[model samples]
Target: MSSKVPIFTLSNGVRMPSVGLGTWQMTGDEGKTVIRNAILAGYRHIDTATLYQNEDQIGDALAELFAEGVVKRDDLFITTKAFCHEVAPDVIEEALRNSLKRLRLDYVDLYLAHIPAATRECGSHRTDVKVEDIWKGLEKLYSLGLTKSIGVSNFNESQIERIVKIQKVPIHVSQLELHLYLPQKAHREICKKHSIIITAYATLGSPGRMSVIGADGKPLFESTKNIPNELNDKNVKALAQKYNKTPVQILLRATVDMGIVVIPKTTNPERMKENINLFDFSISKAEVNLLEAHERSKPERLFWWPNVSEHPEDPFAAER
Candidate 1:
């Protein structure tokens, strides 16, 4: 296998590994093992969020590694996000401090405003927080040096532009649901204009998750007539077979080629190693052209889109 890709430097001068282990569904002991193994496997970046409820497990693993002198705290790039309805200055500060406490770290490498919500509804978890107010609080955190870098998740072009205009500092990253099925191309242009790096989640189309608008609960990437549909387009599968790689690896290479960071969340050790093994291969221009041709195929949104009618903060409402 080729040498692992070096970490990417953020717009703020903070270096973050382009590939990392995402800890979304992982929980309890399973969460710790996934993180520790990923670290031992040579992953320096780890993605986590308060909503995951596994911060304490990550903390324990990091503590254990530190005690064993396996890795120094500065060597690892840790990222965590704070959800909407916690954008109040005090609440945001408290949430961040709590994250630091749970992760057993002095500060996080990167902290994101998980979702944009309104200030009045922040403490009540009302899910109506405004994006600008949240940006204000994030800027505060950046100024305080409590977070090495500050950014957003699930933000669109317009939302990102507004934040850039008002931010006291530049945004270093914007995490979004980007995959073979749903590539947010237009918004990516806006991010590029602001020098904001895009980090993709659900990089595999999240095959195991439920569809957002389907009542029958169709899988995000269902196959038809022995051919994979959605993100697993015949072309993608063909490329995967040609390279002796999984469709997931193809999707990841495509995103990485676009200069976007990918984090495919999985607790399975083999899969974790498989997901990060892409540095050894490179996709050709012709292959990327074939994948682009299928880009207009039906797009799928996997995660929750709660009360879209009521929540303007909802990212799913943003145009793809």
Candidate 2:
């Protein structure tokens, strides 16, 4: 842990770094190198999931670092999630053990339910498996000390509330696709009231990934044209100039100022260095207000799963 980066204390009293490296699309030897470089670059926290398929690479990097005495096991905070299909009560522990095997670690600092919806092996949504049942499995893992803490990702307020009401352990964090363009204020408020820390992914507005062309090479989201790129936004650029910082720094700082943790992924060494160098500067209250005002009145979600939206517990479809 770099002294420059601050750490947030979870409700369970675990310390988590406020800024982390997200290993979403990173894989293979290249991904291993990226994880190694990020650790050397002062990133004490790293986020990955079973769906990412790069846990082994991350494991390799951490093993090297630990073997070389570059960092101790306790010095790092690693988080991984169980895939939606593995959320069933019977499969939860097995799924976690498999992830631990891939990560080459005895335990993970935090484990999350990857999504609110459940799925079967045939790639079909399972409406019968409820969130409460999956939560019981998470509680089992926590009690066994397989994970120091447990949480959820991509869960809405109502779904989170349902779990919280029946859960024996408190929800430690809620990971979401949040950035300047899509602040998700409503969801943030709900989490805040319940003492659930917000972990933001796609913190950069996912610059070239907002819209993807389909198999026929056409746009995926209809509102893709209406979404503004935060990196190129006039307001962001002006703020960068005013603060003598890059747009990325300004955007990341905005989230940090609001007490939100950000995990911005990048394999570029230079960008990795730049992402963690956000603590030296502080965005003023007025400037933060102006930056927050840049949020769209209507949400422009970059990630949408229309196929799973029909699920009864679909977090996105549920009202806030």
Backbone clash count, each prediction separately? 5, 0
Native-to-model Cα distance after best TM-score fit, residue 243 in candidate 2, in Å: 1.6
Candidate 2 deviant stretches above 4 angstroms: 208-226, 318-320
Clashes of 2: 0
- For candidate 2, give the lDDT: 0.88
lDDT of 1 by residue, 11-89 (tens): 9889888888888778899999888888887788899998789999999999999999988988888999986546655
* Poorest 10 consecutive residues by lDDT, candidate 2: 207-216
In model 2, the clashing pairs are: none
Candidate 2 residue-wise lDDT, 57-99, digit = tens = 9998999999999999999999999987888788899999999
Per-candidate local distance difference test: 0.78, 0.88
Error of 2 at 315 (Å): 1.2
Alpha-carbon error at 20 in model 2, in Å?
A: 0.2
Listed in order, each prediction's TM-score against the native is 0.88, 0.94
**Top TM-score hit:** 2
Poorly placed runs, candidate 1 (over 4 Å): 1-3, 118-129, 210-231, 307-309, 318-320
Error of 1 at 134 (Å): 0.5
